[model samples]
Target: MNETLAHEDLPDGLGLRLKVDVTRPLTDLTAAVNALCDQVAERRATTVVVLELAATPVDFREWPGDVGIQAVNRWERAIRRLEKQAAVTVAVARGTCGGPALDLLLAADFRIGAPGLQLILPVNDGHFWPGMTLYRLVQHLGVARARRIVLWGADLTLDKAAELGLVDQVSEDLEEALHTAAVLTGRISDRETAVRRQLLLEAVSSEYEDALGVHLAACDRELRRLRRTRDASPQNLVGQAAS
Candidate 1:
């Protein structure tokens, strides 16, 4: 299994289209992650469309010595960076998504799964691999369902995943999903989007009082920008002339 990652600009500069083939070893996956990070850091796209292809299962146990652990760490960091840095990240799951592929889906802002798509966890010797993937599942699905997935070895079907908020959309057509993602990313500045995403991420761990100041600041910034736009409009100019 040779995992690969590539990206190209969407038509009319709408965003970037990223294709990820997950059937590869950790070394290749790490390289792919690095490439993705560089692409996002360039800030050439406002939204990222992640096409997750079928993934070949990865066994962490097979990674020899410290090399395996280091690769895993780097891979996780790269995925986190993509989620935080990209203005809007949307993932489309086709066929089976497991291991590293599932990790990327969990990090995405929006997830769309194709019909018959299955989400799998890594199991070795009849036991689930205890890793950060567990944290992701728990964060998205809460404890009970995450437990079912991690401990009971349950696979998430497309409909069930959508019902549980794991997948935002279930579409048979990949193009439709991409269109939906592009539409959803419309009319927002990348910087503002990043701020809003940060707020949401922090809200999960912070109390209302702790988050109030940041939220208020964001509101102030938005209001000022709106006022500036209103003042610059043709309608405002006409009203001033009449006065």
Candidate 2:
């Protein structure tokens, strides 16, 4: 909420990485979701949108039970958008994560956890909330593994989450970890990044037989792209002259 400390809507340069500081919503993020969309829609400049989660899982039990179904649906859609956003979405969790925080983290392309980080099931009156996060947990860990966390409310320590590949990196120094993440991703353009993400998602969700066609199409496109590059290269021109 500190405007002075937060980066502006857009990144200043190619070297800068923008962190999308999550506002711990009391009921929903419907109002702020547009900001998330805008961050990803930036076509001119490559950006890395980092969502920081520290005061998360702040007693979801205390949340009012009056959230409407429509609001929840909108929230779910927004989270999906975040997952497929062009900007490389990064989640940095410190302390406990559950509810919306957990949802965002799971949707991120990269996840980093600071020391003392933990994950908890978002339960309401003894049952887990049937949000996109639940579906994502199943997608990430599969049915057998997510069952324990959802049905039994099992909490995961940072080390356990990292072992499961839920948390990509664990660091005592979060800033350095963030910088490392930026380097690792190499900030591809937004549309291309989203296309790649969609391909990966389909690889997981699609049936084995159905996956082949999709992969073949991608392969064809890649081949064409490579051919274009090769034909335009200086070596190819020299070889053509020699021939």
Candidate 3:
């Protein structure tokens, strides 16, 4: 999978650029995802990013449920790790984002879709697909909305996606949107961003009081780190010091 596609470091601070032919077979989807995760870790990129609908669906004559489950598990683990480690994960989308693609897109902190982008949640194909998508949606956007999308298997346009909070914004040009994301990514402090992300997840999963405690502790740690950085800027190694 790594050898099949070329990855370019965008000169304009675009992080990593992945080019996937959406019309091709995705038998290597799992491997591609793993490679991307490795890249994210190696680069220490504040925003581990992706441009969506890069690969086309692989049409298997007979679906292998076991392989599908394994792919789902690997994807879920990778997404959780990347989301936690990266300061501001971003997804720039064009065309249709569905199935495993949608899974990856939803994992991003900010999703910017193009004018013709479409979001498809297809869990009702009269077959057993993993329930993680529904769970994540429920966790992000409440149960009712999750049910509406999962149980009914609704497909949404870019406008509806923005309205439903699925995508952050829809841009006429994808490159412009990516450039905008690059600027936004540059402005955020990694430690504070990571802490807020964790706190937000905790607030979603835990009680309010517990969430408050975690947030306050995160704030304290951030403040102390800032003070240390201010006091000792010239002493630390390059790219190893506090951001």
Query: How close is every model to the real structure, measured as TM-score?
Result: 0.85, 0.85, 0.80
Off by more than 4 A, model 3: 2-6, 21-27, 44-48, 55-68, 189-191, 229-243
Ordering by lDDT: 1, 2, 3
RMSD of each: 3.2, 3.1, 5.4
Give the candidate number with the greatest lDDT: 1
- RMSD (CA, Å), candidate 3 to true, equals 5.4
Model 1 Cα lDDT, one tens digit per residue, 99-160: 77777788888888888888777655566766677877887777888887777788788888
Better of 2 and 3 by lDDT: 2
lDDT of 3 by residue, 1-243 (tens): 545444556656557665644333345655565566677667654544554555344432122234555655675675677667554667777777766567667777888888778876634345424456666788788877877776666678888889989899788887778777767775672657877877776676798886777878887897998998876677564445646
- Model 2 ranges off by over 4 Å: 1-28, 62-65, 187-190, 237-243
Q: Write the per-residue lDDT of candidate 2 for residues 13-123, one digit (tens) a residue.
A: 433333433343533354455555764575456677777776533575422245777777777777887777677877888887776677778998899998788887677
Kindly give the stretch of ten consecutive residues in candidate 1 with the minimal lDDT sum.
58-67
Collision count of model 2: 0
Per-model CA lDDT versus the true structure: 0.72, 0.71, 0.65
What does candidate 2 score on TM? 0.85
Which structure is stronger by TM-score: 2 or 3?
A: 2
